[model samples]
Target: MPRRLIIDLMRASCDVPFVSLARTLNIRPLLEARGAAASPPGFAAVFVKAFALVARDEPTLRTLYVKWPWPAFYELPRNIAMVATARVEDGEPCVLPQRVGDPDRLTLAEVDAIIRWGKEAPADQVPAFRKMLLTTRLPWPLRRLAWWVGLSFGRQRANWFGNFAVTGVSAYGGGELHALSPGPYILSFDVAKPDGTIGAMIRWDHRVTDAALIARTFARLEEVLNGEIAAEIRASRASEPKPVRAIGA
Candidate 1:
């Protein structure tokens, strides 16, 4: 069964706009195909790579919006960082691999390696992962207190921890096309369809990014995915053929 903790956390604080964005992307068919595949590693790698490439091309895609009483601000970053939670065994607690970035630069082999490593990391790391997972474990009042503390020190320390958060549902048979939540920084994508068509849903912090900027970023990403990146992948595959051994006389 899914963790009750996670479920409750989501119920209490779920972003309805984010969910709506997912629904708009129309990723069901793609997710269905992915789920049916015997091996999904390649697909997952491709999706991650695509996201990375898109982020690279459109730096704003990696940014977050921060709202202040007077005005809102934007934060620009170089990479799209995300977290992945993996369960090592049935009924075992999930371990989170934090801040996997630049998925586009990683080859399928590399992605597979990382997944393997993430799942098998030392037991000691598990506790840290759990802590991150249970960040919502704090009572609402305590959470507010921490946020206040974080904000109080952030200006002087140049650290703003709650800039943004992104969660991936593709691994769970959720359809292609990522979704973003409106915040300092939040984005998600649905699984890709078998036909190579993808829908991208973006939620931006209105305070930081206007609709025009978000649209521009999305358009650039579409071009990258459908044009150069897609072409490159196809070319790479086409250049390689299965090797056969010659029969000895």
Candidate 2:
């Protein structure tokens, strides 16, 4: 059944110790530039790249607590984002995750295109969706085993799930209170306000690091969004049609 997928995910998530931290980010500059762009990238894409850029410099953001053969921390080489995208499956709506690897190295436009594809593409066509369907179809015992193995392993976990996740309910008029994910980091952001403020929250695993690092990461995220992310939007305007000059009248 469609519900089984989320149920399985919840079962796996319940085992992790997740702590959430929230902050209001001022991104008026990025908002203004994005609004003027010919094709504005989705907020998810923008946030994904911004967070990844911060993670690129902060290894703590890239670290994960794995309980496989032994309990230890595993740091990924790059950032992988598991973005939760809503889709209609069997005539019912469901949220499925789409993976975007090394988002820091990707252009905002590139990340947006991939996210748009995940939202618009057929559920069966999206690899993540298909994989989830297959896993859920397995017997209960097998399903539990699959989740355990996936969560226990390090590299396989990153490749299968991701180092972080992005999910939001901003389109529905608010943000998620405590969004859960199997990854070490999961970020949720609300709609941008007229004054350029947006509600952002990160629910991270406690076994990896502490709040001080995440606080600094949030500050750096705001900087990246206003700096390089805004610059990218302005760059997109280069392709805009130049205003015609009137001849002397």
Q: How many residue pairs clash in each candidate?
A: 15, 0
Candidate 1 lDDT tens digits, 98-157: 344445676645655555555677533654344434554577677556544433342311
The residue-by-residue lDDT of candidate 2 on 47-163, one tens digit each, is: 999999999988888888888799989999989999999878779988888989999999899999889889999877878778878988999999889888888999978887788
TM-score to true structure, per model: 0.58, 0.94
lDDT: worst 10-residue window of model 2 = 169-178
What overall lDDT, based on C-alpha atoms, would model 2 receive against the true structure? 0.88
TM-score of the candidate numbered 2? Answer: 0.94
Which consecutive 10 residues in model 1 have the weakest lDDT in total?
A: 154-163
Best of the candidates, TM-score: 2
lDDT value, residue 29 of candidate 1? 41
